[model samples]
Target: MLTLGPERWGGGVIFDPAGYALTVSYVLLDAEIIQVALRDGRRVPATLIGLDLEPGLGVIKLEGEGPWPAAPLGDSSGVAVGDTTATVGVDADNDLVVAQGSVREVRSFAGYWEYMIDRAFIVAPYNPAFGGSPLVNVRGEVIGITSLRLGDRPVVNLAIPIEYFTATKDELISRGRVMSRRPRPWIGVYVFPGDHGVVVGGVSPVGPARQAGFRRGDTIVRINGEQVGSPEEFYRRLWQTPFGEEITLVVLRESRLHVLKVRSADRYRFFRTTGKPPE
Candidate 1:
């Protein structure tokens, strides 16, 4: 079936016998209305079940008849570099478009959007239209889902390892999100790479950072007494704290160090207060 987002058309895989499907969370963001085009030329309305942003996966359900076609999920842990794989995209005629490629590598991928996938596979020579398309091994069992077009010359692409979904399916179905981990603690400060730490590029108007009197152009030196040297390090340390707790932030503003105590909140909660989309 097809997944048409607010302003774009991407595809998703029906991976469960009960009409539950999967796609990237970005396509599902702010998607108040979604329609699915079946292979038999029938369109079905879909409701978003839930989403897990850590790996950028979204679960959607087709409100239709029973026993839809579902693909078998394979063990992604056994997948290795150099293994042949294929991803299915939608063609101009709205038909399944399958492309073949080889897995180039498996590693962590951190996006500039404050997103991080602990594990992702790099595949080569495949179509980028494979967004949210299932990646199947030679056995035809799905191992991953195409996520991005990293490059073109050598055909590098990225896919979210399937195990992320299989392991959290029940949680998504129940809570609309994973509850195994509490939401990350957020101070609501936008940061950039700095000389020895993350520089505060901007502060959210109503978030903890601004409420605590933090200003722009301040360098984050430490979080709760622990020194941080980079943007990644700062985020990693901040997330380790319990949400809604007060912590001291050591920042250097114009070479003068100031200790500011701020109460952290769930990132999603802050978004709600700011009138931003929860996703």
Candidate 2:
């Protein structure tokens, strides 16, 4: 990740089953490669590991053997919605970054556990780079993996709940795969916060919507022949359709009305990470 500011790049924590070590994962905006400086002032090379896409967490491993201490993984199940939490990571120029926040909401998404927090503050006060940092409880046990901030809002960072790690640990080690749950699909694009009217901010490039000529900036007016004057009406119509079924989308774009047919793709595949596993 590119480190902002004029500060120099530095080391980060690396914990494997064997032990813990410091490695270079963050870099200055102008630096091409990251180099780790040990506690004794010796430098070493590190390699990037796989990044968990949904959670937005990335991992990297060091090359040489050295003394290192590993942090313990905590039980996320014991964490209540209002409990306090802390974040730890290295900031730009190698300084330690820490923050505190309170859990705001705890809920599930797509049958996967998740949580949100409020009043979080970070010191050394910088971005955690690419969401690989860990969020710990008061006891210093990691309960979450830092991810990206929601849109351009940096303060409201998102994290992947540790429950995903706990549930998939054995599976990750045994079969190198996590058990996946699938969502039923219906064709077409959607906009949330329906009461305010739909703003076409995104489009599935190759999904049924795109194939049907749905483009960004197209204001949806109807779904399956039903008037969709608002976001709520659009979502309601989409959900009412059967999974894997074809549907028609009629939208107003550039003052023109166009009709298109869209077929849904498997929701699970859409969220899965792409490319080869981390080295």
Candidate 3:
């Protein structure tokens, strides 16, 4: 539940006639007031409709009436690794910015913030407005949402496939999330790959891991006596365990092996859904 700042700017696409828009979920986190800037220099107030953390997408609704210009959604499943794409977004001046790039690879991506995507698009020629930008195909149909910029010299952007949103759009809009899917166990520990095992980079301030006696630079070796070699494996093991269950973790800290137990919680329950700043 870390706040990035008091105000954040990102691009979004209206996908419904009723002013419903879609953007990366990170932009909507801890948002108390939302104002959408249109191309015609008009800023319209908006409200948080819902958020789907699995796919890292968020829904918002304009506070005005009538139909809006909606972008056509494309099937991301049909997108190939070498497909061409256009990343479209707005800059700090509210001016439209578009970048042409090709999909370098389609693979799974794991983030240190306890986030993982099964199928993601890795696009080259990173766009400056990577966050919440729309990744459109040649036909101008929105296929994915650019979520992050990865790498340094050969910078690339990670786009979450759009199919994840379409599959559960209705449920997300209605219930503020997809209710059918089982919630995963989240300990809120930020980890990275290490030589011996997964290294603990940091822990969320509001997460159970903060009080679970996990120190920075602790190398996680096993979960419930099962060895974990990478961050992906650690996440898989963590999610496989039922939520609210105690998870035993063996860590190598300061040349000593220490055993720590932490109870996992649902991430959705820990985050604010009303777009109000935490008190």
Candidate 4:
């Protein structure tokens, strides 16, 4: 398993009267214990409630009963490019930090780790404390949750639109996942854009891809005979197929074409959803 580290820190928003907090899912992955710090300097222990991997969102319930301030949820669909926005998060000192910026772009975003968001926000002037930060509109309503910092010279933050949450919030809180949606097939390969096409960077040690003879530097050309030009296309094609199905991958390695077959599986099967580490 890949270790993110012993300790992780990120911002989150309390968006429920019952102390349910929303944040990026990566932070809570394999977490044995969670602690939430409020602006008033109160550090309260929290418990993992659920995770929605599709949009990369997670929810945690803050311990204790009394009055939690819930941020008003806003409609992200109305958010437009060039609209004023603020990225709000807490620094290491637990002090509120806000970065003023505007929506640079609102479009689809794809990551190399088999993740994609159809409607995402690209906010400018990159917030250093972006992980789990709340992107607020002019009305001070939370419109999105900042997930990652993209680009180099002119960095921008990618915010997952709030609409994704509002649509399935109840399902996540009740079942720890959306039961209505079918699980996407996961091969566990890390791929990036290459000169000719998508190239395999590495494979998960426990994922089916590793056992299927996939190697680093293998340029992927097709999935089941369908051409894949980019990482986004690769993910879309892969997810369209049901889990546990045999997947055919054609790759160019060392100037020779090789055909590899792998049976994909549900990613949750390998992930630890409980607060306790696997015993």
How many pairs of residues collide in each model? 0, 2, 0, 0
lDDT of 1 by residue, 21-119 (tens): 888877775566778888799889988887777788888899978799999989999888999998877754678888898899999876644466778
Worst 10 residues of 4 by lDDT: 270-279
Instruction: Return the TM-score for each candidate structure.
Output: 0.80, 0.58, 0.96, 0.95
lDDT tens per residue, model 3, 1-279? 354678898998998999999999999976778999999999999999888887799999998886899999999998888999999989899988898989999999999988898999999788888889999999999999999999998888999999999999998887787879998789878999998889999887778898898888999999999999989999899899988999999999999999999999877777776453333
The C-alpha lDDT values of all candidates are 0.79, 0.51, 0.89, 0.90
For candidate 4, the clash count comes to: 0
Note each model's CA RMSD in angstroms.
4.8, 7.5, 1.9, 1.8
lDDT of 4 at 2: 50
Q: Which stretches of candidate 1 lie over 4 Å from their true place?
A: 1-6, 91-95, 151-155, 187-192, 199-219, 250-262, 270-279
Per-residue CA lDDT of model 4 for 1-279, tens digit only, reads 253666899999999889999999888876788999888888999998888888999999999996789999999988999999999998899888899999999899888888998999999989999999999999999999999999998999999999999999998888887779898899889899987679998888778898999998999999988999999999989998877999998999999999999999977767755453333
- What ranges in model 3 sit over 4 Å off? 274-279
lDDT tens digits by residue: candidate 2, 1-279: 212344544334455544333222123222334466554556676544333333323344455764555777778766666678876766554456676775655543220111112222232223454245677788987777655454443345555566656655544333323435333453435454333235464565435676777777777767688877655456557666776778787766777887877876653343322123422
Please, what's the RMSD in Å of model 4?
1.8
Better of 2 and 3 by lDDT: 3
In terms of TM-score, the best-performing candidate is 3
- Model 4 / residue 23 / CA error / Å: 0.2
